[model samples]
Every structure is written in C-alpha cells, then in structure tokens.
Target: MSSTANWSYTAQATIWRCLGRNEDGILTFDRPVVIKCDYGMNARKGSLDIGRECVIKNTIWTEYGKASVGDYLLIGKSSEADPISAGAEEIIHIQRFADTFERNADDYALFTGGD
Candidate 1:
C-alpha cells in the first residue's frame, strides 16, 4: 500500500488510508470514502480546485496555520518548488525534479505526518 511515483494519487491514497482499516491490516474498499479536512485543501474544506496552470507549492494559503484554498484563487500557472537541499541530496533537485517528481525510498520517512 505504498506509492513510489504517484503524487496526486498518493495523496488520494492517504485520504483512503485515513478512512480505511480492516482485520488483516488491509483497507476494505466497501464503499465511497468521505473526507473532512482539518488541513491542506484550498478551495473548500475538503477540495482543491486548481486550474491547469497553477503551481502547487508556491503559496499554499493556510487557515490558523493550516493550508486551504479560497474562491477563484484555485487556478493559475503555479507550480511546486522545493528549496531544501543538503549535501549528497542533490538527487532531489537535479535528478528528481529535473527528471520529474519521482519519489525515491529516502524521499519519505517511516512515519509521515501523524501517521
């Protein structure tokens, strides 16, 4: 249940995992998933209505320190750019973003966010 090269889908999977759990440590996909946002998504409480030209990382507006989207601010020629770079981690900027946002094993942590 891990995604290596999928960003938006990975986020959606995160949403799924949030509401998924089963006896065998698997999520039972029995019905549609309902999500409530306490963070992230900009436009509405649980929606990110971005247009075709928006960058995801330039300015992710927040509410009380939590990110959210508002009205027509949803669309644009925006993009997500990561500026953190340590030595030996050049793979992130040059190799990753240049080639594409392909998340390697080290790109994530064992326990992400509150997981």
Candidate 2:
C-alpha cells in the first residue's frame, strides 16, 4: 500500500519584490514560503497527518510593511517547491526568509512583518 498521504500547507512570503514599468508589472521574490502550521486532527510526533484536500489559511506575502494574500494549493507529496516521498513517516514544515536582495532597477519593497 502507498504510505504517501495528502497534506495541506500554507506558504507566506517574508519578503516580496515587484518590478513595474508603466502598466506592465512583474512579481518576484527571493524566498516566499513560510509554513505556519499543518492542518489536520491526526498528528504524529511534531508533524500532522493531513491526507487529501488540505487547506491553508492566512497565506500572504508581505512587502514594505504591506501584505497581499497569496494563492497556493498543497499538491500532496512530490511538489516543485518542497518534495516529499510517498509513505513518509513525518511531514516537517519548511520556513524560509529573505536576508538580502540583488541589485536591480526595479522597485523593491521590504516586508516588515505580518499583515
């Protein structure tokens, strides 16, 4: 039997950047995925056992002290953002933060904190 289970997770952006020229705009980020917590009643150890149709709440990205809700969906194990193996024992949350930025002419906005 496949041990892999579907889990829902939330991703929040610590720092977000955008480049715009006139009406055209581009959204970019250094590291935009902060897992707040797992959603499920069946939890084991420190991770939660969330299988199938996971829901994430309060998923937003922040910039210049301003935050915008981010749209994302948990695609079980084996995702591009974070990879997981089937039949995994535990599901550890991943948290990432932006420390620095690259030089560019585009406008940059620094996120202070949560919205």
- lDDT (Cα atoms) of all candidates against the true structure: 0.20, 0.25
Give candidates' CA RMSD values in order. 17.9, 16.4
What TM-scores do the predictions have? 0.15, 0.19
Question: Candidate 2: where is the Cα deviation over 4 Å?
Answer: 1-24, 40-67, 71-115
Q: What would the TM-score be for candidate 1 when compared with the true structure?
A: 0.15
Best by TM-score: 2
| Residue 44 lDDT in candidate 1 | 19
Cα RMSD of predicted structure 2: 16.4
lDDT (tens digit, per residue) of candidate 1 on 1-115: 1133333222221111122447888433222222221124222122123322232222221111111112111112222221111110100000112213332322221111100
> Candidate 2: lDDT of 107?
23
Clashes of each: 11, 3
